[model samples]
Target: MKFIKTVSLAIVGTALAIGGAAAQGKTVKIATEGAYAPWNFTGAGGKLEGFEIDLANDLCARMKIKCEMVAQDWDGIIPALNAKKYDAIMAGMSITDERKKVIDFSVSYANSPNGFLVAKSSPLAKMPGTGEAFSLNSQKEAAEKAIDAVKPVLKGKTIGVQGSTIHAAFADKYFKGTADVREYKTTEQHDLDLAAGRIDAVLADSTAIIGTLEKPEFKDYVMVGPSITGGMLGNGVGVGVRKGDVELKKGFDEAIRAAVADGTITKLSKKWFKIDIAPRS
Candidate 1:
């Protein structure tokens, strides 16, 4: 009787595991911002070409599964993910403790700090802290020093950033009340405004600014000030999955780690952003 009972328990465990696997294998839909350039923005021809698109494709290849990517507004991406509009989100979203409460992450695949973008000829291009890196969490003293140094040059200047992004968070943390912060729905729209002299400077992701700098219309725009991460900027970008999908989350985590290990992510990052930012270490 003891042996029979043990065998039954083992069989039940196996059945439960198989059921979990089957549930995870049921198609996954990935969502992206679809407006942030060099991340997941739509091109002039309405084609998606950017870092997130490339990395998402690479991860799907690693998983050896058929997946669909949907373009949605950034503000609604997370809520929609929770609402089942998509199984996961691949936008350039930082994995933070607050965000963790509502969803899970599939490992961070890429990271670039919040950086400043300005017209090449603008005085803001000469702002202090140029070509430097600082972390608000690791080295608060130095990060504040950098902020204090840049404050003078940015004083009373209008800064443009996308609405509801980490950039906005950073502006609130460091530049709020000091600089006039304007928010835009799309990076392209702000890029146009910056080109038209509507805003003195723009704060956003480094890779996104690279996309803006590549455009003929923004031929003279440049990155200035310090590259910042950690603290309010939060952790690196990752695939956000719904809560309670631990099986699906584990599959994606394994696939993402495998892709990074095989250099698939590095290759795609370079292909799209001209940089190599695979899983860090």
Candidate 2:
């Protein structure tokens, strides 16, 4: 009788462990700002589609969880995640220190630099260091020089950026005094303003700029200036979760690593951004 009871207790414990695992894998609610094109966007039928969308599905599959992706406004994405409206965020969110103070991020799956979009005829089109790349953390002097080189043309010009983003922070820090920085609610809004000549240029992710440039209306537009990364740009794009969700974080981290190793991210990035934005590390 003693041995039978001991065996029954062991089986109960095993069942409980299995039940916990199943509950954890049941479903993961993910949020994405369906406005950031090529990263994520609303399609013709109000369906969410983009690089991050595909990557989110892949990551969820790797973790053996069903993913339900919901479109959330960009400005409220982080707060919504904290409110438990969603279990995770795969909205091309960069892992900046300021953001990390609130929510934890999984291993970065992609990294892309930021730049300016200007009309071909604009004086800023000739902004110096056109094809150069700079890491403010690794090469501060050169990056600062590159930044200074473009300031003259940018002086007195108005630049548009999506509000509450790193690009906005960058413009505020580096170009505020020299140039008028206008914050828009979305990249599409700023692109419209740029097309209407309301703003001289738009500062944004290179991938996003490239997406805009592909449109027929933007035929005359071009991405100018150096590609800026590191420093204020943060540590690349990752899946964001609440700070206390360690198991969920671990699952995403492992999934991302697996996806990176298998070239899945590279394939999806090329399909969307036409460039490899895979995290270097």
Candidate 3:
């Protein structure tokens, strides 16, 4: 879901663990933005629970390394990783060329499309190509055409997107001048604003939009418009680690491949997202 952010050195806060301290031997402190539900989020009593949380545990077991999961703010997640605040990140981070310059990513573990969320009663609920899908990378013309189809309906609407996300960049590129594209610090923040009627629509990962729709408070909201993937949206979601951490990256890659091969990813994704998001490539 992420776009890009300049790395910062400022220390934010102490990382909070979701699991008990790991046993000795090369503990990998994994950072997660414990707010994006279905992907990762803080559960009851501050316990972390979600797809990535489960996947992290499985991957760690496969790697035979001690794993520590910690909560980190989304905006500074990459910077924190570079700053040594965490050994890796598994917070539904997309593997984009832009991000690869600052950090390395393991082979993609999951892939999902991006879309819009709007009130069921809103006119945008009739957004064109509502259930259709397009890839900006392989279907550039079609994807651009699909985007053009939604522009008129979104022209004067207010759209909310999580800051430092591909959705933010997409909104800026296509909807900023015509629509009021607002940025929030996290998906939950935007979801709140959307629920409060502060925003006309929200552009985010379809899985995240689905997460919002699962909430009773968000029952009136519906995912609309074409599902978008690839291009600036990123290759797919992967494990983000410091650029120099080749061994760690290699380990994660192997583990993820195994997980995908063995249907671990499929099982976890279905458990959380109700669909298989395992990367096909």
**TM-score for each of the candidates:** 0.89, 0.92, 0.91
Runs in model 1 lying further than 4 Å from the true structure: 1-25
Top TM-score prediction, candidate number: 2
> CA shift at 17, candidate 3, in angstroms?
24
Sort the predicted structures by TM-score, highest score first. 2, 3, 1
How accurate locally, in lDDT, is each candidate? 0.77, 0.85, 0.86
- Give a tens-digit lDDT track for model 3, residues 1-281: 54222221222233223222222243568888888998988777677778898898888877766667888888888999899887899999999999999999999999999989999999999999899999999999999999999999998899999999988998899887889999999899999998889999999999998888999998888999999999999999999988777777878899899999999999999999888899996
**TM-score of model 1 vs. true structure:** 0.89
> lDDT per residue, candidate 1, 127-147, as tens digits?
888889998888888988998
Residue pairs in collision within model 3: none
Candidate 1 backbone collisions, by pair: none
